[model samples]
Target: MATSVKNNSLPPSLISNLNQVLLSRQQHTIDHQSTNSSSLPSHSRNVDEPDCSKPLLLITNCEGIDSPGLIFLVQALLSDARFTLHVCAPQSDKSVAGHSLTVQETVAVCLVEMSSATAFEVSGTPVDCVSLALSGALFSWSKPVLVISGINRGSSCGRNMFYSGAVAAAREALICGVPSLCLSFDWKKDVSSESDLKNAADLCLPLISAAVRDIERGKFPESCLLNIEIPSSPLANKGFKLTRQSLWRSPLSWKAVSANRHPAAGQYLSNQQSLGIKLAQLSRDASAAGAARRLNSHRKNVEIESVGIAGKFNGQQTAKKYFRLELLEETEKADDNLDFKAVEDGYVAVTPLSLSSTDQSKIETEVSSWISAALGREQRN
Candidate 1:
C-alpha cells in the first residue's frame, strides 16, 4: 500500500527554509526586473515580419486567449529578443478537454489584439488550436522553432496531464515533429494571487531560453516534451528539479440527480419545443396550399407525441437517472523525485513526457544532463 500525504503536512523546518529562500530572492528579483525593463522592448515584433534571425515561437493555453497567465508569459517572452512569438489559443476555457479535436464541425478562428505578437482565438479545444495553426491553414509558417502551451491556471501533474488541454496542446506539437513545453502553476484557491503567475513566467524565462538554444543546435532531448509545474508560491519555490510522473490523482465521484434537476434537461426541453414550433408552421403552410396537409398533420402529431413522452419521462421520480461529477480526495504514496511531490514541497517540477513507451533510464539521463546544463547546475546522480 502507498502512503498518502496532505498539502499541509510539511515539516516546520522545510517551511522555514522555503520562507528564507523567498525573502532572499525578493530583493534580487525586483532589481533584476528594473534592469531588464530599460533594455527590453515592451512588445515583441509582429509575427508576420520575415525575421529569420530570431526563431519563431508559438504559444497557446487552455485558459483561453485573454487569460492573465498567458498574457504574463507573452510579456516575459516579449522582453527577451531571442524569439518571435505567435499566440493561438481557445476563445473560451477548455481546461479539461484533453486531446480532443473539432473534427465534426467547422472551427472558427478570429484575429485577436495581442501586444505585437500575431494572435488568434479559436472556437475549439487546445488541440484544435495547435493543429489548425500548424496545419499551414492559419499562419504563414507550418513549423515554428518551438511550441509552448500554457502557463495554465492549475497543475497538470500525475494523471491530470491526460485530461489537460494545455498538455494536449504541447503533445500535439510534438506529434507534428516540433519541440514543445507545457507550463502550469500549482494554483491554490484564495491563497494564490495573480502576481504569482507573473513570477512563475519570469522564473521560467531562463529555462525557456536554454531550451530554445539547445533546440536550435539540434540537441534537445529526442521524442519527449517538457511539462513544467510551478509551485503555488512561485517566488518561494526551491529551484527546479527534474522529476518523473507520479500515480497521484484526485478520484472522481458521480452524484445522482433527477432528470428535471439536471442542467442539460432544460436545454433539451427548449430545443424540443423549438423543433415542434418549426414543424407546426410547416404544417400550417401545407394546409394553406391544400396539398400534403395530411402528411404535415401526421408529422406534427408525432412531434407533439414525442414532446409528451419527454415531459412524462422527466416527471417520473425513479425511471430516469442523471449525474454530476465531483472530485474526491484520495491519497497515494508518491516518491520524493516524482512531479507531484516536488511541487507539493515548494519546488518547480519538470517532467519529460513521450507519446509511447520508451527507455525510461535513457530519457531520464538525457533530461537530467540537458536541464543541468540549461540552468548551469551540477547534474544529479
Candidate 2:
C-alpha cells in the first residue's frame, strides 16, 4: 500500500535542520577535508578505501517534468533524508535515449534546493550525469555506492531492454563498479496518472533501500544490477522476487489507401505469373468486346480503385510504427509476469547483470563447478 504522508508536505521544523545539513555539506565540499572526516559515511570519505561506509546514492530520472513517477520517487528519496542523495537528471524527459550523452551542447546543472536532500538537475543524459556525479569534481566520494537510474514514468524490460535510459544509467554505474538500482512501473500512455506513481514509489523506496543496505554489507555478488519493476496495483504484491527479462509482440498493423493511384499495381505484381494463363482463358471463351468486359470485371474484382479525383488526392501514408522503447517493455513485461492480481500487487524483480570487463565464460564456469564436486562427478560419471 502507498505510504501516505500525514500533511503531504514537509514539516516546518525540518527546514532549518535541512539547511544546516546542506550548509555543512557545502563547507565539506569547499574544505575538501572529507578525506579525514570519519564522521561522514565511510563510502563518502575517499576512494582509496574499498570498503565504503556512506551510501552516496545518485538518483536520476529520464522523463523530466512529465513523469509523476519520477517526481514522486525523487520526493520520497528526499523525504527519507538518509543517504547522501545527489541528482543530475534531465530538465525534461529524455526517456529512451539509451546511454547517449549531450556532449556538444552546453548542459546545465542547477541545484534543486529540496527541503531535505541535495538534488540537482542536469541537461545531460542519465549516464552523463552519473559519470559527473561519481567523478571528484561534481560530488566527491570515497568509493561510489548506489546509483539509481529512475523512478521512471515508464518501464524497461524484455527485448527493448537495450534502449532504456533508466537501465542504461544503472548499467553505467555498474561499469564504474557501483551497486545500482533501476526502478520503473507499468504505465499506459493514456491511462496512468500521478497518484498511481506515488503509490508505486511507496512500495519501491523501502525495498530499494533494503537492497542498498545489503550491497553495503557485501551480500550481493560482484557487478550485480537490480532492475525493479513495480506493478500499477500496489496492494496485492508482497515485495521482491528474482526474475528474467521477457519479450512481447504487440498485434497491430497499418494499411495505406489511395484512389486512382494504380491500386491494381499491387494485385498485378502479386499475380504476374498467372496473368498470362488468365488472359488466355479469357481469349478462348469470349469475343473481343466480351473479353474486354470480362477483363474489366476481373480488374475491378482484383483491385480497389480510388473513388474519384478527390479520393486519389486523399492518399494516406500508413506504416506500422513500432515503439521499441525499453522502458515501455520493462513496464509491460513486469506487469504481465509479476502477478499484479491484488489491489496493490507488485513484485520487485531482482535481475543480476554484468558490466565487468572479466570474461563471462570464466564467471559462468566458476559458478557451475566446484573442485571437489567436479572431481567426484568425473569419477562417478
Candidate 3:
C-alpha cells in the first residue's frame, strides 16, 4: 500500500488494484528467479562453438530471469558466431540490483555445463561474479574480451541506474581494466507491457554485437561502461539513443519501528484504511512526514519513501532513496536541469555512465608501469 489511493491520475480503485497486481508480479518474478534451473542440459556441449583457447566475453547478470529470460538471453548471446560465453550469475534472485557482496553466507559458485553456454552460479555480487569469471575460478582457459552484464528486467534509468547490479557489475569490470556493458529493458510496472521485454532484447542484440566487435578490435573506451537502456516497443518504432548519465539527487529519510509494535505487520492491512495509507506513505519515503506536514494542499504532493547511505559526494554521506543518489550540482539552479529525457517515444530512458577516474586509471597505469619497468630490466639484461 505504498501507493497513493487519493491520486486521481488513475482512479483510486484502479490504482489500488494495479499496485497490488504490480507488487504480486514483482514478488512472483523474484521468487521464480531465486530457484535453480532444472531445464539445463546435463553435460556441456562440444559442438561448433568457438575454441575454448580463443578469447571470450564474460557475462554477469541479476536474478529476475533465473530460468526463462536468462535461458533466452544465453541462447541469443550464443548466436554470435565469434564469442564464447563465459557466465557467472547468481544461483537465485538478486533482482535488478548492484555490487552487493555476501560475506558470511555459503553462496556456491557451481559449474553449469549447458549446450550453448558455460556458466556458474556465484554466491557473490554481480561484480564478484565477473571477478570470479575473469579470474581462474570459473574459466581457466582464456581471458575475456569484455564483460557484458544484464539484459536486466526493468528500465534501469534516471536514478534507478545507480542501484542496478547490472550497471554496477559493468562498472566493477571496468575498474578491473575490463571492457563492460549493461543492458536493460524499459520495464515499468503498469506503464510497460510484456511485449516490451521481447522488443528490448531485439534492440540490444545488434548494438551489443557491434560493441563486442569493437572491443575485440581494441577500439573500445578505456575504463568505461555502456548502460544501454532498451526501448519498450519495436526497435523501428522505439528509436534508440546513445546518452550520458543524468545526475539527479533525490533525498529520503525515514524511521522503522519494531515488528512487535504492530501485530498485523508484513501483510496488507484490511481495516482502518487511513492508517494503512499513512503507514504506506511513510514506507515510500522517509521524508514523507515532513513533506506531508508542509503541503498545504494535496493537489500534487510527492513523497520520498525511504533512504539509505550508499554513496558519498565530497565526503558528505548522500542518501539513496528509490534508487536515486544525492548528487552535487555545479549550478545553483535545479529547475532548468534538463539531464535525462526518455528515448524512443519517451517510453524508455538510457543513462550511460562511467566508473570513477581513480578506479579506472589506477589499475591500468599500475599494470602498464609494471610492464614498462620489466622492459627496462630486459634491456639491461
Candidate 4:
C-alpha cells in the first residue's frame, strides 16, 4: 500500500484481523507446536553431514532473523545437501505485514543462539513466523518439508504482491498444505555485494531444488503457489518466466510528518494495540515502479524518519501520531502476462497463488444474497 507502506503503524483493520487470527490457528496450532518441541530448529548434528533424511528448511523473513537476505539465504541453504536450515523469524522488521498475527501482545519464541541455522526469534508476524513454524510452535521432531520465504530485500514484484510479509510467508505455506517458495531481491540487488550475495544465492539454487521437487512430487494445485521474482541483474537476469498476477497500478503516495523528536513517538501514542506499528512515510516506488526506469531523481525518495513502535511500549505514555492509507487494489484484470510482466521484461518471474479467491461464480448467485440478507435480519428479530 502506498508503494509498500512508505511507513506503517499497524492497523489495516488490525492487519486484517491478524490475518484472521493466523487463519484460525490453522489446525489447532499443530497440537500446540508438537507439545513445545524444545523450541524447534537446533539439530545440526553433522557427523560427516549426517543426512538424517534432510528436508526441513522452514526459513522465513520480512527481514529479521538476521537479515542479509536471511544470512545470505542461510549460507546458500547450507550447501544444499538438500536443505535443513530452520528459522522462524520476525523479532523485528515486520515490513508491510500482510498475513499478520501476534494478536494481543506477548508472543515471544526465542531460541536463536545458533551455530548455523535452526534459528527462532519470534515476537511475531511474517505470518507469525509461519504460524509458529507450521504449528509445531517452534518444532521438535522437525516438520517443515520446505517453506523458504525470502532471498526478499525488495522485489516481490508489482505492487509488491499485495504488501508482502515475504509473500505472506509463502501464503502461510500454501495454507498449511505446505508447498511454498517465495524468494525476492531485485530493487537493484547489490545487497552489499559478497559477490552480490553469492549471485543471489546462486540465483535461488534452482528454485530451491524446484521447491523440494514440488513437495516430493505430490505437486499440489488446489490453490498453490511459487512466487520467485529475483533480478537486480542476477548474472544479468538468468532466465525464468511463467507469470500471472499483474494488476498494474503503482505510484503510491501518502505523506505525514513530525513525530516530535521521534522516540517511536512515545510508543506511537502509547500503543493502540501495536503489532509492530512502524510508520515514518515517504517512498517513491523504487523510482516509479520496477525495471529500474533510471529516473534516479536522487534515487526517487525513500524515507522512514521515524515510527516503529510495535512492542515494548508498556503503555501509559502519550504524545502524537498521524496515519491513514491502507491499499488493496485489484478491481479486475484477470491477467495480462502478469507477475509484473516477467520482472519488467528481464525475466525471472513465476507467479501462481491461491487461498480462496471466492468468485465461485458469485458463490451460488452473489454470495447467497449476502447470506440471505444477514439471515433475514436475524429471523426478523
The number of the candidate with the highest TM-score is 1
C-alpha-based local distance difference test score of model 4: 0.65
Residue 254's lDDT in candidate 2: 41
| TM-score head-to-head 3 vs 4, winner | 3
lDDT of 4 by residue, 1-381 (tens): 456647658978998998998988985788787766646543533312324577667788897887677777787778666666777788788768888777778887877655566677887789888877777645754356778787776666666667889998988878887777788765543344546656777777765665465457654333556677766667887466656666665455555645554556666546633522332122332333542444344335532233533344323433235554544323344354577656656667766666765653333333234223433443464
lDDT (Cα, tens digit) per residue for candidate 2, span 101-191: 6776787877665434466677788777777777666665544567777778655655445677888888878877887778877666777
Query: Which scores higher on TM-score, 1 or 4?
Result: 1
Runs of candidate 3 with Cα error greater than 4 angstroms are 1-55, 64-67, 191-195, 236-238, 249-340, 344-351, 357-381
For candidate 1, give the lDDT. Answer: 0.85
If scored against the real structure, what TM-score would every candidate get? Answer: 0.73, 0.56, 0.56, 0.29
RMSD versus native structure for model 1: 23.7
Candidate 4 regions with alpha-carbon error over 4 angstroms: 1-58, 63-85, 97-117, 122-147, 150-157, 161-180, 183-210, 213-241, 244-321, 330-336, 339-349, 352-381
Q: Please, what is the whole-model Cα lDDT of each candidate in the order they appear? A: 0.85, 0.61, 0.58, 0.65
Q: Pick the candidate with the highest lDDT.
A: 1
Shift in Å, residue 354, candidate 2 = 2.3
Instruction: Write candidate 3's Cα lDDT for 171-210 as tens digits.
Output: 8787777777777765555776645555665555665565
- Which parts of model 1 have CA positions greater than 4 angstroms off? 1-47, 258-263, 266-320, 329-331, 377-381
